[model samples]
Target chain A: MSERPAHGWQTVREEVLRRIAEKIWRPGDPIPNEADLAAELGCARATVNRALRSLSDDGLLDRRRKGGTRIARQPVGRATIEIPLIRTAIAERGARYGYRLIERQEAVAPGAVSAALGTAADAAFLHVVSLHLADEAPYALEDRWIVLGTVPEARDEGFEAISANEWLVRHLPFTRAESEFSAVPAAAARSGALDTAPGDALIVHRRRTWLGDKPITQVDMTFAPGHRIRTQQ
Target chain B: MSERPAHGWQTVREEVLRRIAEKIWRPGDPIPNEADLAAELGCARATVNRALRSLSDDGLLDRRRKGGTRIARQPVGRATIEIPLIRTAIAERGARYGYRLIERQEAVAPGAVSAALGTAADAAFLHVVSLHLADEAPYALEDRWIVLGTVPEARDEGFEAISANEWLVRHLPFTRAESEFSAVPAAAARSGALDTAPGDALIVHRRRTWLGDKPITQVDMTFAPGHRIRTQQ
Candidate 1:
């Protein structure tokens, strides 16, 4: 089925893949052309194209420029990345989830923080230091700064009762954000955050969220060594 | 607009973010709820939800329970993991893309490969080791094993001209896939895959793609110490 249709790419791909997998089109065997499949399925050629395109991307078929499509000789690995909530991810894995407000204070925005918050450098900002836990073990250290100019109500919204994630979900109203994932060798402070050895490689997720036409928050989320975020495509 | 809409989430998000950048909703300003947004945009609520949910996730709005949503005090960093061709990623970064044909043997699958390929444990399999280069720099060392029993035709397919990634995309007919992302300290032989310093964090992508119920490929893609993949939500 098309994304526009009830049966999306997953459904059609399943049907086609089952045929090939069952040796309906054994390796080296040519599969039906897109036109034929489109007509057979009462769908457009584009729908078939999407299915084939994804299958090819996943390394299941042999599609060449004008050579047509065939079953792959050997399937290649297909991997997907999943984004997860930090707290649940830790807890589900049988780890304790804890948060510590290391630094929470009212301050003036620095140039960089101001730029990130889309506020003037002199704007009031809330700087909060937080440590995250997994199974009572130190997992991540977060150095988060909130724009007090933008969140006056946040001045007294103690983070002790709930987690920043849950609080943000409830009070923060930005409709857009960006997440950057990277790996870096650990520095001392970072090592302290994760209870890691010196020079440990850390998986870093730096996230920024924005209100409509306004800058709001910047969070630096650094994970302990061996931490992973799973995702699918 | 929807997935079928001219602008996908990416395009819409950028536009909306720009509006917010322009201060349509300044920091701490309350924005309309999603329902009102859907109405104003004349699009599906789901689309609005996707956009809004992403925004909330990014920490732009201070979302509350019936208290309404507002801009964050400080904007979060935009964390984007760029999903590019592995080859392109290395090449663009001025490293040589390298490959090595580890073992070109046709044999029955091993335990895990068998289960993944949906074939007998002894299903014909092709094992190869290839290294990815970035401008003559070692970026990734791949230990790839393919099960030919499920897709036997790859037995004679020459993998010389193209990278496994490119070759696989051109060939294969898979329907569903699952992948896992992890960060692990380098294993023994792996330490030499990309000439990494021992104990550096290596980002590992473990994946298994399926054709219908038939397992097709199981692969482990290990990045060098500094490789990063970015995705925006």
Candidate 2:
């Protein structure tokens, strides 16, 4: 074994990936033990462990406490989707960002919305509807429901200058969140809000955030047709 | 400082996350240095560093080599999407999985397809169209283009019993991949394959895989309406 100093876990990870790509370590095959690999590569066993743990997180390897490590039989592809503020996203695309408040009121939460937030069906929520614009064109239509019990301050704010999305992000920090991505045909109201023809396909991102165990807010943002979220890995 | 033995970096991470969630460490504020935190928490500096690094990876903290770490001003919510084999996905939903080959041929790649694959527009590619089913109902429609040069064995394989998606996972490995999620109006052919009405909104997942710098395959999988990809964090 070459007596090279340990460069880092990242270097070890790249070497392992190269071996996998070259089929030197074939799929479903057991890899050398960490101590053996460390000795051969002139790296600490902890470095090998870290690299393997990271590969496991990426769904590329199976590392068991006692069963040893093996190449994943059916490696799954994992991609990270970063949900950013609409204004930030628009700015990143080099477009001018705009926001318009359509409606805001305290209304009874719908059954589905209530269920999503784990609240009573007849619970009152601060409902806010708004439109996000890019370069003076309709970009996304947002419909949001803020739990009044969790965010009583929202009841006083008019939400005219800043969107509920931006306001909540600025004021509240959530400990947990859930997101769902789907496609839906634009309804009449949604089409009008987005300046799209009725029945046009639209991408919808639905998110619910919570502080500890208490529900905070739920929002659905429907993007205009042809919007795509892309990621490279 | 607590004299307890370092439970692990994970425990330290949880404590840090609690501090952030409770606003003890406000957004955009510089966090305690690793050495200071380690001393206060009675852990190794490396443990504090690892915890901070993990938080940074989660987009909750911003770390700099010289400037130190700080709470992210605009913390981005990250969701990990796992793209599994269609059959496996169906099985996980407790449904019987089925697949039918719709079309298979060698065709000149379209301009958009070639651009996505980083190949010549007129390059010849093996094109395959198929439908996946769950519980005897249409699930997802898959359209794929495979580079013959990168996957020569595919030219010989019929892909009758197994899908190219599974076959490639078994035979080849990719070093890099890109995925795009979008909403599209189903064309006549796609609608027929998915058994949905024309103009129905479909969630389309497009992916391209590369082995090193050489392109391997590009595929588009369109899910039927009402299908959502959900993740929690």
Best by DockQ: 2
Q: Each candidate's TM vs. the true structure?
A: 0.66, 0.80
> Candidate 2: where are CA atoms >4 Å away?
A1-25, A30-70, B1-72
Off by more than 4 A, model 1:
A1-15, A18-84, A90-96, A107-124, A186-188, A198-200, B1-83, B90-123, B186-188
Isolated chain A TM-score, each model: 0.67, 0.81
Q: If you assessed candidate 2 against the hidden native complex, which CAPRI class would it receive?
A: acceptable
Model 2 CA RMSD to the hidden true structure, in angstroms: 5.8
Candidate 2, B-chain TM: 0.78
What overall lDDT goes with each candidate model?
A: 0.67, 0.84
lDDT of 2 by residue, B3-33 (tens): 3445688889888876765667767788989
Tens-place lDDT per residue, model 1, A1-233, is: 22564566666787777677665765677788999988888777887899999878766677987978877765333333444556766777887788776777888756876776578878887777777887678888776777665556678778775556556544545655666566666653545767777656677776776656556677777887777665454
- Kindly report which residue pairs in candidate 2 clash with one another: none
